[model samples]
Target chain A: MGARQTLGAVTDSDSSKAKRATARGRLLPANQEFAVFATVAVCFVAMALTMPSFLTLGNMFALTRGISVLGILALGMGIVVIARGIDLSQVAVLASTCGITVVLLNNGIPAPVALGAGLFIAIGIGCLNGLLIAFVEIPALFATLATGLLTLGATRALVLPQLIVYLGPENAWLQQFGGNLSIGLPIPVIVFAVVALVMHVFLVHTVLGRSIYAQGDNPETAWLTGMPVRPMIVTEYALSSAIGYIGGLVMVASTSLMHLQIADSSLIFDVILVVVLGGISLTGGRGGVSSVIAGTLLIGILLNGMTLLNLDTQTQNIIRGAVLLAAIVVDSLLHPHDEETSKQGL
Target chain B: MGINLSKRLPAIAAGAALSILAGSAMTLAANITRDTSRQAFDTAISGKKVAWVPLWMGVLESEWTGIMKDQFGQYGISLVTRDPNFNNDAQLQAVSQLIDEKPDVLIVQNNSTTLLAKELKRASDAGIYVVQMNMASNYVGDAYVGVDYTQAGHQVADELIKQCGGGKTSGEVALILGEATAAPSIEGLKAITDGLKKDPTVKIVSSQPGDWDANKANQIATTVLQQYPKLCAIHGFWGPMAAGAAQAVKNAGRQGDVKVFAISDGQMGDCDLVEQGLFTKALSNRADVQGITLVNAVLSLLQGKDKPGDKHLFYFTNNYWIESAKDRGYCYKVDKAK
Candidate 1:
């Protein structure tokens, strides 16, 4: 709900309006996605031409690998944003869940068991968040925020002896997710691709997925049409948390340690940035995996280039903020808010 | 039976006589008297209130708090701590409330150079002694207990020059800073910049902020390594975050090529990393020592000799280079407060 207003205001697409436009024989609504994709391409070529190290195989691998974790998280956030819900708790849940998993592994729990229990806890937190938002009628923004704090605090108090939990030497297999796979492609990139493919299939082909979109489009219409609106909302959040668990796993695997301090970093806002930058409309039910991919590429390239240029974090943050502002402006110019489509729920 | 009883009675009587003599002698040897100076010491410190407002309770802050708590308890002083959890607004509120509570001494770790300047002034005006730790504010307090980042940074840079400068290796060095605008980082960077002036051949090829995140450090370090495989040394501001940079170099098979040097909070983890060869050397300002310094400052203030905000005392702590296994004691093991 916090990021929703900020992101939702910049969201250009209204699925219902787009449907009406299509019904009226207009094929093209706007080219926000195209504009973003083109910008990414332009930046890519510019960086490659200017920076000698940009196009190397190693640099390319580094860029994609870095984006994998963020992309996975953005994908999860994209689903919730499509449902007109926000998840401020994703990073917190990810850190705590994966943190507890490593702690268990250190205490002799098998890899599979620890991983399962970790993801189970993550999904459970998501369900609690869903219950609060869907059935208890609390706003998603506040609900996730409170839950995030509760989970992080609880995990810190009960399990983590400190802010960081390092992976023990016994878990070499678990570390493979962060390493290179066959043909030298980083395992995180592979995992991201697999997740994107699976998520794409789920959203396009599943009945529950379609219902999530319908509910986001209009909760009143969705309920009136006898779609299990409450259950769908719960499932949407569960999916977001579950996917976030994968990102957490990759994070721990790659870094060999999970520092809970990351939950307090600006990583979540970056995830939201990728979601919106990819052309996923926070207005709900307007973007998918492709949009997330496009957004990730742009950001991944920008960050990688900035790193190559050795710009300080302050300068990089300035550029990042400017880019987000520019994207919002473009989105607003292309799709001005109309009174009929401006009914707010989140 | 009668003969045995008579013999045993004589022996028992002798033992009783010896016990009486020993008791009297012991009391005579252990004569008790209270010294006026000791009484004055107790009177100066006992029942005094010391309020601590740290930026947050990380490993470093926790160790510092642990030591302060133990020392204060021994001195019969009361200590209260408020953890702002790194939120600036919350810290400001905590300081405001602490001022109203009117503790005899207030110690704080400023999140920035200016956020708590006004409130600190208010506390000083209220006749409270203030001590700042690690990072200082625009408003200097009664005492400052922390490292001189410029000196520490110069030492680190000089160490780097010895390792990679004057055509020893490829003169390329990389810097992984904690935060761009943090006072410690700013001062440290300035010192490093000035120190590098002594060695013209050494080139700083890359500089970026890790924002105190290990993952960010890992990613950036990985990219930098990919770009400059011949990078001679990587200097980082903090230890835990620099562990990621070390790991990145290790993963690239450049661990032997790249020298990793950093300054740490001197927690056990930094020493463990050093022993494991993750860090070539670490210049640590032991948090435990800093905590003890803070206690000493508070105790001095509570002595009621120094005027509040008038006596600007500083306890610039000594730094330790934890390089080999022998430097283990330099890094404190924060298992239990001593």
Candidate 2:
């Protein structure tokens, strides 16, 4: 009887050990990004195999260039969301500043000075958003929404009453940013790549970056642990605004103008969609530049393909909204939050 | 007896003088009546009130407002304008309120065909004369003064066919619409589709909506260009929006190869773009002329001769094709003060 009991105990211990090993593997395996990246790859391969025109150099370049601006904005939004915040005003900030830049340039201001003024305004608005959310105890969602309306309204009233500013002929140098590089790649795509690399390094290697994650994970705990959680929140939003300005520049470069009407369009929602669709959980504290790139790529490919297929806007929007809903559902299932993990302010 | 004779002689002299004066006065009155109809003119035109509700006060609508205000003011009529700023609900509210105020004329530019249909019917039933501009609604108002977009579309497509139709080019064409459901856009698309059917060689490779956005046009046009490098011509619904597609073609270094056509509100910006060779050919409906037409329609309706909704009058203004620098006059200049 003792021998039999010993054998049974050994078997039980072995089974428990195997179970623990598998659980650890599940915890640390290729993350949500891997799944998204895989999906992108599969779509790309399928598109290339089926659509004869999809593999062409011109089409490939166009696809990348089209997505470059969206990718950049998604990256910025991802950073803010990683720190458990949202930015509904990113597009408004971008449109207003870009309009100001063009209006200044058209008035004979030098391109460099005009560009600086635009970036400065964008960052200022972003910091203002941060101040409202962090210092005034306002929710990011409501604060950013109000800030966006205020920014657009003020810009429209004070500067671009016409709401559309076209780049002048003298601004060829400014327009080059939207053009091609010597290597036959779009400059915007190159800009997007460089921005992504820098962001990846900043998030993965820096102390402040880790703090953003911790703060997003549990802001109260992070504050108790001596992190300057408030300042970190400000920095996150400021960065988002600054990067959104870059995306605006790309947009202006590509189109040779800026239409402030975009402030009221679905662009901000699209940015958020791409960010979250790539597995950037809105509940906060997860996702990086890779997730943004994956999201951008998937969206880019889908849009490019749909355009090729000549689908109408309504059909396209329906598919896009469905995909976003599915992504949100999947995110909730994968990153289940208990009562303790929910942010205090939320 | 001597007194009576003297009195009679004085009376006869006075009678002759009175006859001469009365004859001259009658002749003068007859001439004046033959030359002028002052009372009728005053009753028809002077001291009227007109209320205009536009979709928004953009360059085009503002131009219309400036023209209307100036002309109506000159006619001794009071004009009130409410700018809805592209919000349909606000437009509906403005129309309803203006109807209640009971202005002699209520002119509206509908954002959609049905959004203001009920309100317009209410205005007409309330004995208010209604004028619809640029876009018409299902409830036809008293008078409609705008471009016949279907004809404009045919003009644009015909121009495209001239450049890209029978063996002149690769025959691959694309169309960019402003909005899918907008009456102007839908009628224009249908007309272009029908017009393109005339030339079997020309094949429409892609037809998409830009949603009246320049950037969206640029993006879609860029992708279409990539898919069809040998694309012969591209047509867009509006000039300002089509300018983006032109920019795309220019960016692709295919500006000279691709002929771009559009029916645009002939704003100065459209002229500038055409002069810069961004657009190949533009069928411009002179907004300035259309604005004048709107004022004239108001004048005709307010002659106090017709009941509300009694006259279904339409003033289909002509469209001009802007092809070269010399055709710049076809596009109207927007006043800065407006």
User: Candidate 2: misplaced stretches above 4 Å?
Assistant: A1-30, A344-346, B1-47
The CA lDDT at B85 in model 2 is: 74
Best by TM-score: 1
Query: Of the candidates shown, which would achieve the greatest DockQ relative to the real structure?
Result: 1
Q: List candidate 1 stretches off by more than 4 Å.
A: A1-31, A182-184, B1-34, B336-338
Which prediction has the highest lDDT against the true structure?
Answer: 1
List iRMS for all predictions: 1.4, 1.4
Scanning candidate 2 chain B in windows of ten residues, the lowest lDDT window is B1-10
lDDT of 2 by residue, A1-346 (tens): 1232233334454666445434433553326677678878998999999999898998989898888999999999998998889999999999999999999998999879999999999989889988889999899999999999999989988987767777887785776888777665888899999999999999989999888888877788899999988878788889999999999988888777788878877788889988988878787777889899988988999988988989887898898888787777666545543343344552
Residue A324, candidate 2: how far off, in angstroms? 2.0
Evaluate model 1 with DockQ and give the value. Answer: 0.45
lDDT over C-alpha atoms for residue A312 of model 2? 82
Residue by residue across B1-338, what tens digits does model 1's lDDT show? 24323423543454335434433443355441233444655766799998999988787888788878877898899999999988999999999999999999999998889999999999999989989998999999999999999999889889888899998788899999988888988899889989988998888899898888888888898899889978998988898788878877766667768999889888776777788777999998977667766776676677645678888888898788998987777776554423
Docking class of 1: acceptable
TM-score of chain B of each: 0.89, 0.88
> For candidate 2, what's the RMSD?
12.4
